[model samples]
Target: MKLAIIGAGMIVKDYLTMVSDIPEIKLNAIVGVEQDVPTMQELSEKYGIKKVFTNYEECLKQADIDTVYVALPNFLHYAYAKKALESGKNVICEKPFTLKLSEMRELKKLALDKNLILVEAITNQYLTNYKELKESLKKIGDIKLIECNYSQYSHRYDAFKEGKILPVFDPKKGGGALMDINIYNIHFIVGILGKPKSVKYMANIERGIDTSGMLILDYGNTKVVCIGSKDTSAKIQTTIQGNAGSVIVNGPTNVLSDFDINLNNGFSKHVDDKINDHRMYEEFKKFNELVADHDMDFVKKELDHSESVMEIVDMALRDADIQLG
Candidate 1:
């Protein structure tokens, strides 16, 4: 697939580090706002990209491009993905597909009506290790409790404290602990367990944004707690407790690195499936398959799952009394 990148942010560097090794995909161009032309051109040159443009319309007019990777800020995802789909290009949008469920629903309908592929670029759901974790769930028997925590202080927090509200901390830009960091924990849980019967959130608010929050998901028989924080740090781990045994996943929820299984009366097993590459690797591989096979079914399923995630997030925000601009 010939891919045009819509943003040149910190994550784009990680994507470039891996895309160079994949033979099936090509970096066709990098596009950004007019003020970011110099940076985009530099990235294009460094990554051997063929073209660079400051206008979205000009970039979308490139007929050779088969897909567009919308890596812009959270708030821009819906608009950019909609335009890309309208332009007949498959879109691989970044996480928290949109701030609201209505926006995601609209994008999903547009992609389907256009017969195009649209996927949320969430790493955990695409990783092989996560699939294995799902397979091991049955071994643990009836699940009763789940605890997931993904917390790391954001680099932009300092600037936020200084009254410079960056995207990571700005409500107007879909910024908050829930949308930025907590979403990973939600994906790891929801992808495996499906949607819960009820959802609620308790968040620490600062300037109308959630800096840290605890999400409680009730599945009737099972209870799950997801902890996400950008104002503090924690030993990131995911634990699935069941009647017969339990499973423990180490490393961040976004990066499924290592895991362990302990049975009630048997020896425990340690699993180490650490991949050195950045989290973007698995997502790109999945996108390639969706584009090559022209699989609308797979695309729709992913979109539906993303929509559910956003629905839960929206409800959680309401429960916590947080409002985004």
Candidate 2:
């Protein structure tokens, strides 16, 4: 996976830190705006990245890379991913794949047509613990209810309150608790249950964006409620209940770092099968291997799951009458 990162933001820095651990993911180049050249250069030098480009087209045309990682602001996901697909490179986009379901479908179609791997860089889907959690569900009988909460009062929330709107809280930048944080819960649910029968969102709106929200997903016999917030904090946890037992996640949905399963028969066990401490490592390692193998079957399955998640997000936003870029 010869990769060219498309942003110089915090995620890029975080990614650079552990990239060397996966020798398959060669950091070929990084592309950013002219204003970010210095930061990009510094990162390239520190991380041993081979090239830095201030122009996207030049990076796409000249960089010795086969994949692009879209780590830009939320609103830029669709356009940048579309461009990478058009440029004949595989893309690993950050979560909330796109603001709209239509955009997701378009990207999926283009990737299929071009025989390129287009995947969302979501963490839980590839985590070992998350996978084990899914398998452990069979021991718990039929699932009845699921509740996931991933709320952390953002440092930017204070500024947002004072009318200093940054991209995170800005409506036009696809910023909100739902898109920014809750999407992980959506992915966690949708990945396990496929799609919901109905979707609804009740949000705490401030200045046109959701500062916090409760999303209800109806799955016939199962009921799921996902809570996400940028204005409050809580112990991040997820619970999946069944008539015979239950599974409890001890950490954020994004990491699924620890969990326990308890049965009605008094049987219980804790599980943590994670390969790496960093949440992104397992996902990227899998991404690199999949891209290396050109495993479109697995990629397509993930794309289907991603599409379901996007559909739920679109429905939730529409139900709340929240418009975002």
RMSD of 1: 1.3
lDDT of every predicted structure (CA atoms): 0.88, 0.94
Clash pairs (backbone) in predicted model 1: none
Candidate whose TM-score is highest:
2
- Angstrom error at residue 3, model 1: 0.5
Query: With candidate 1 superimposed using the best TM-score fit, by how many Å does residue 310's alpha carbon deviate from the native?
Result: 1.0
State each candidate's clash count. 0, 0
Best by lDDT: 2
In angstroms, how far off is 185's CA in candidate 2?
0.3
Clashing pairs in 2: none
Query: Measured by TM-score, how close is model 2 to the native structure?
Result: 0.98
168-231 per-residue lDDT for model 1 (tens digits): 9999999999999999999888898789999999899999999999999999999999999999
**Per-residue lDDT of model 2, residues 202-269, tens digit only:** 99999999999999999999999999999999999999999999999997899888999999999999
Per-prediction TM-score: 0.97, 0.98
